[model samples]
Target: MTRQRVSLRQELPLLVWLVIVWGALWQDFSPGNLLFGALIAVVVARLLYLPPVELGGRFNVLRAIPFALGFLAKVVAASFQVLFLAVVRGPRVISAVVAVPLRSRSDLLVTATGHVISLIPGSVVVEVDRSTSTLYIHGINVRDADDADKLRKEVRETEAGLIRIMGTKAELSALNQEVGA
Candidate 1:
């Protein structure tokens, strides 16, 4: 079997991110330190069996800004909601592992959506069914079918927002058609 050729453009983001993380870890911003970090990053990138991350080739900053703000708001509200549930329901808080079937089959989008949902309080991704592009999320205060439906809807909406921001044109078109229909 032959290895797939990876373009420099595809690898650059990972290398740059590695350098930034190295610098952050070392708490150094000096030019010499950064140069050294860059060296290490390049060496690591070459030595590691890294998988290629497919990019959308276009990013919509305008779409990203609103999504970010909305995510922050959800974080805040979920925090308060979790706090309320903890105080009122305590150990008796109703929780369920709700299955959320996502539209996008892209690993990047599905993972991003799972992360965004898990970052907010009261829910966490318990398992991911990559074969089905599904996320099984354990949610707090999900007492019935309605609550579970809301959780699934919330997770899918997050995926839609991510798709709008940087999804491939095909994915965006499909999403648009789905919404229009």
Candidate 2:
């Protein structure tokens, strides 16, 4: 079997990110720490055989601003909602597993969406069906069909925003068709 060679350009971002992460973990930003982290990052990147993620999409930083803001807003709102349910209502809170169908076939989009949803307090991704591109999310306080539908809609809207920020034209067109349908 032949090994695929990864270019320096392709590994640069990963190397930089790893160094930053290492610095953060050690809580040290000194020149020595950074240099050591860079060495470690290079070694890890060279030794580790990981799958290559194809980020085949046009990234719009302008669109990312609103997405970031919206994600923050959702985090705050979901925190309050989860707190209210857990503290105020306690045992009466209902939970349900809801399946959210994805519009984008891109692995990056699906993985990003899952991470975003799981970050929110009231929902967590339990499973992902890559075959059908569906996410099974465990939602807190989902009392009825309306609540489930609302949760699904919120996830779809979040995905739509993500697609706007870093999705290919084909994914965008698929999103449009899904919305229109």
Candidate 3:
């Protein structure tokens, strides 16, 4: 029988998260509970083993700090702003799908941008054109083309940070230059 080796990179962190979640869910540690937790851990590890993009593997935790903090602040502020618009202004307020041309070449950055947009209350990522590197985002409160453009810039910055965290500084710099041009 060939021995299956588990890499610490792939297994340890997953195991920790599993254990913490398991502990929270079950106050009593019976045999069945232990087995269930182990099964859950195995399933999670299996899923982690097959990530859609491998870019997150190189994620620099330090570079991610600013993005995480900024994302939280933006989300909180946007939530209230969106709520106010929704409550005060009826559905007559403008909404449109704007195409944002992505600067970063990495699929991870593109995906991250889509996710961040979706997380915000007023916007949703409808589609991403991988070949053209453009994001189609539906904005509920977009007033004009300028608003759409501003949203695109914000998304680009957030995604650029993700690229930097994933160790693509050179690629991101080139992308930034292209955007500037």
Best of the candidates, TM-score: 1
| Candidate 1, 25-71: lDDT as tens digits | 99998999999999998888877867888887778999999999988
Task: Residues 1-181, candidate 2: write the lDDT tens digits.
Answer: 7879887776777888999999999999999999999999989987886766667447889999988987898889888888788799898888999999988778989999999998776789999999888999999888899999998998888789889888988887777887799
lDDT of 1 at 119: 78
The parts of candidate 3 lying over 4 Å away from their true place are 1-20, 27-40, 43-52, 167-170, 173-181
Decoy 2 TM-score against native = 0.85
TM-score of model 1 vs. true structure: 0.90
Question: What is the number of backbone collisions in each predicted candidate, taken in the order shown?
Answer: 0, 0, 0
Against the unseen true structure, what C-alpha lDDT does each candidate score? 0.89, 0.87, 0.76
* Candidate 1 off by > 4 Å: none
Residue 174, model 2: lDDT of: 79
Comparing 1 and 2 on lDDT, the stronger one: 1
- Assess every candidate by TM-score: 0.90, 0.85, 0.71
Is candidate 1 or 3 superior in lDDT? 1
Instruction: Please give the ranking of all candidate structures by TM-score, highest first, separated by commas.
Output: 1, 2, 3
